[model samples]
Target: MKRNRNFSLLLFVVFLGILFITFSVISVEARKYRVKKSKPHKHQNDRNGNGNRNSPGPAPAPLPHYPTRSTIFDVMSFGAKGDGVSDDSKAIIAAWKAACKVSGATIEIPSNFQFFLKPITLQGPCMPNLVLQIDGTLLAPPNVGSWPKSSLFQWINFKWVQNFTIKGTGIVDGQGYSWWKYSSIYFLQKNSKHIPDMKPTALRFYSSYDVTVRDIKITNSPQCHLKFDSSRGIKVDNITISSPESSPNTDGIHLQNTQDVEIHNSNFGCGDDCVSIQTGCSNVHIHHINCGPGHGISIGGLGKDKTVACVSNIIVEDISIQNSLTGVRIKTWQGGIGSVKNVSFLNVQVSDVKIPIMIDQFYCDKKFCKNQTGAVGIRGVKYDRIIGTYSVQPIHLVCSNEIPCTDVDLIDIQLKPSPGYRGFHQALCWNTYGKSQAPLLPSSIDYCLGKNGDPVKRIEKSHEHVC
Candidate 1:
């Protein structure tokens, strides 16, 4: 009887152990299911209050400005020949001058014709609610030899304007092929210092307020396609800018000393930075952009030449960059006192990019650079949902040793090497500090980035990437 009772006890113990093992397996599977569903999707906009956006449909171009047609001033009526060969600069200027006097007026360039213009300035203390509608094409004179020696480097200048809209399906062609002969990426790289300065950008707005630019096609600029300086409350939507990959210094859009600006639904491919944010800029938002075959988007070599600079509250989201040298970057000169804070790059996708994320505290573009000590303070930056394939190193965060980058956070980052290429052992970092959470691929990097993590101290330094 004793033997039978002992055998019964042993079987009961075995049954309980089996039951515990089964329950543990079920609990682990349930927890993993919950975590997978909780990760973030792309946000709707960087500016708006909407939630995450998921595979939105195509967006159509909006209509032109809603100015009253009663006070219309047509360029053709002011002796502007629409023959594509005549000098129409004087006539276009006359129309702008006349329309500037009337409220809600429109300077209309009608379709079915082309106008060739030399350099022109459309000065404005324009009446409120003015619109410049370009339904026809405007061609720029390609003769750089005859241009004035001293210049503002702008083909069309809209100065001191307020409460205006410039919209249409028309094209602005810079005819920049002649300018590109000696000004290409290859030539500039081969001959380090002797690059020729290109001509003017197609359009520039100086000290403007409450402006809207929509539905325009700008092509082949000598410098940047469009530029804005010291402007407030600007919006640019549904614009297309294109140039060859080799075109030198042909940035798509450049801004300096601008505030409260939004650029959305745009496409850009040029030699230089697709969108460059210079000094004294704040509250800028860029969304739904497509960039390709160019240098990619960048925040300035701020504080250059030992100048003070400031940029803050910038956001870039839902962007696609392919075949570009970089995905998102911030560069600052070595000898300057300034700060870049509250910058966020979210939901960016890239393919074949050389460097996906980079922060260079020492940025030098000249033929020679003299190292100095003063540095820009960089803080409060976040990288979220950056997924892509990179041609070279996936991440580079080189901050100044004196003023280390603080509060840099990374979440949901997944990057791999480009096809058929050998992946690097780890990300490169120097004098950088950051934190990372789960959902980061190459999970080993998590070991590198912790609270106040410095990669150089923990990992071996590499000389593979020199500046």
Candidate 2:
């Protein structure tokens, strides 16, 4: 009996030890998870609350203060000669730097004059409240060789600036037609014989906040018209960007690795997308704009190789497209692993568009893209109240053959096919809405195709279904 009791006691001690070990392990993991989850929010909140860095138990850095100015002409005491061949970039930079040192001042460029500016960077590290008001035309240097080269971005950068406003009724001409011509020639030559080198973008903005670019006409960009990376609280309004439709890679506005951005009341006519958002962007709102003669708004060609990119919480509404290639599109590269979720498109009006609505997951360009592991697909995209009058197919949703699309809702979409087209043309719907026909107006559902040409599905028309 004594021996048995001793054995039982030993077993009990072992059980206790195992339980303690498991409990300790679980506790440590839980604490670690809590810390991990709370750290980002804590840091974000601290930055928002304190307006700067977040050091534990210490006072945060004071917010950078900039003086406010009523007019840009108050700080301009110098001017560059209007000779077309003279380099004005250095003079402009010097004047801007001096004005930035003075609080709340405007650096003005007067009217009735033309000046040639070389590729120059207008940086704002210690200055926040400087306004660059141009009432005159700022022309680009004639020679493309005068532009500098950098590996960080194709264009020169305006970095880490805050409260900066570039507003005026002036023109900033990139004089980019020559550059575009050269690039085309280079590409054509390379295609015939060898691989050619890539060129740089026109304008690149990095790590800037509270930036407002308004009321300007920008023309003839060499590469992308405007690009923003890792910027927050950026508002682009009342601007017009125009390049020749044949201009290659002249995207109007491209956003990558950014957050909290809004683009409104703008017009874009370019070769590539009117606005393309790629990789690591969130909380993006694009509204009240006109896009045409270009590729439409896009999401990705994301996650090539081991690189991972995600886009979330994007809204595109109140947009008008005229004679564009595709109006609203979401494209993802094959063999990429990322989720694009909570995207909403509402009140979009299309006229004379090719593919008005498209979600292409098998986006492989440049000599028949091949993926060994199959295509990666998109998740959780919703479209409501999209009306398209198309010369071609009204809506085209092509998912990957392997991983098809899921959670797609299209409501109150009215497509009026162009004359000489077949009656109620092919609306390619696959792996979407799960064997349910879209809610359409009563008069148009008799010949509609749903889920591999089955006819049991009927359109839904509730009074609340009117878009």
Candidate 3:
């Protein structure tokens, strides 16, 4: 009887244990259900107030400038150290993402801070007219090791964004010393494919529209300090771009497949062209710029690799170029088909420039180029009130042999040799048909012509293309 009673007691304890285990499992399942039901909605988040009720769709019309109260997303608030040594790219990107979702938003990089950044692309079809208010310095990494494999083409890129304004007095510093050194060695060896096919541009806006970049300073670019590719409605004002004169391919402002651009009141000192207008660019106006220690404003070396390029209606006026390579130039390659027309340079002043006025259809930067017959057509180019001091010749016009340049005009031109002892100054011309107005200096412009190599009579001037 005692053994049976002990067995019953053991059965009772096991039953109590099973009951407790069952209740614990049910409690765990209930908690899981509650947590799942409490999750936030997919489109709305409380952290940044993103996906709010009034946000516009993709590619909406530009909003009025700073409508209502601006929502500011300071990078410092998003975990940026801003000490120039820490990697602030992720924090800055977080700020941008939050700011891009709201209208009249600003991503502010405050003053007295230096944000060290690697290659970063701020891509958007985000809220229109967003402003990047930069008041601090943005410094790039010092070496190529910091660049990712995919982001070798550009250091800072704004892609597919519209109505964006980048304003304020900040410095964009690209530490390009290592890149310049490596590129120099590669050119000397001529066989190493180590560096990527194209060096990275400092800042590039690709396929963006209605962009305004103003009141900023950029320096030490690896290549092409500022570039606008396949973009429209650009306005650049009150900016300064500087790079070492020996830096390779560091153009101040490079435009390709872009149109409707106006650049004014800027300063540039670089290795390559101060402003390079490449293929498919039209309706451009560049004025009131100060350029030095670089190649002057140029159009083309275009239609490369037997391609067709069409550029028209460009006006460059009220410019000053000092201690530069070439002042105003139009260059195209051989074996290319296209036309560059209705271009005018007015009120330009150059000091100690190499060549003040140049038009070279056989523009070959390489050591040797195969001679080809087909060439791009150049017509209706006018130069007016271009007074300068030149180191080399005053003008050099070498047009295409197959299709000679036509309707070229030079008016009120005066160019003298720089203050030095020695070297004759003469104008060289070939296969270009043009007329020169009176008061042209040095009497060398008499060579400037018609199809029969005679001075073409000036007809009534047509209305110039209004900017």
Q: What's the CA error at residue 309 for candidate 3, in Å?
A: 1.2
Predictions in order: lDDT: 0.83, 0.71, 0.87
Please, what are the lDDT tens digits per residue for candidate 2 over residues 381-402? 7677778677777777776555
Model 1 lDDT tens row, 342-427:
89999999998988888998888877798888677777788899998988778888887666676788888888889875657477
Off by over 4 Å in 2: 1-76, 150-156, 191-196, 374-377, 419-424, 433-467
lDDT of 3: 0.87
lDDT of 3 by residue, 110-221 (tens): 9999999989999999898799998999999888766787987889999999989999889999888888998878778767767655678889999999999999999998
After superposition, the stretches of candidate 3 with alpha carbons farther than 4 Å from their true spots are 1-70, 451-467
**What is the TM-score ranking, best to worst?**
3, 1, 2
Candidates ranked by lDDT, best first?
A: 3, 1, 2
For model 2, name the residue pairs that clash: 67-104, 72-106
Which pairs clash in the backbone of model 1? none
RMSD of 1: 32.1
> Where's the lowest-lDDT run of ten residues in candidate 3?
458-467
Clashing residue pairs, candidate 3?
Answer: 434-449
- Using TM-score as the yardstick, the better of models 2 and 3 is 3
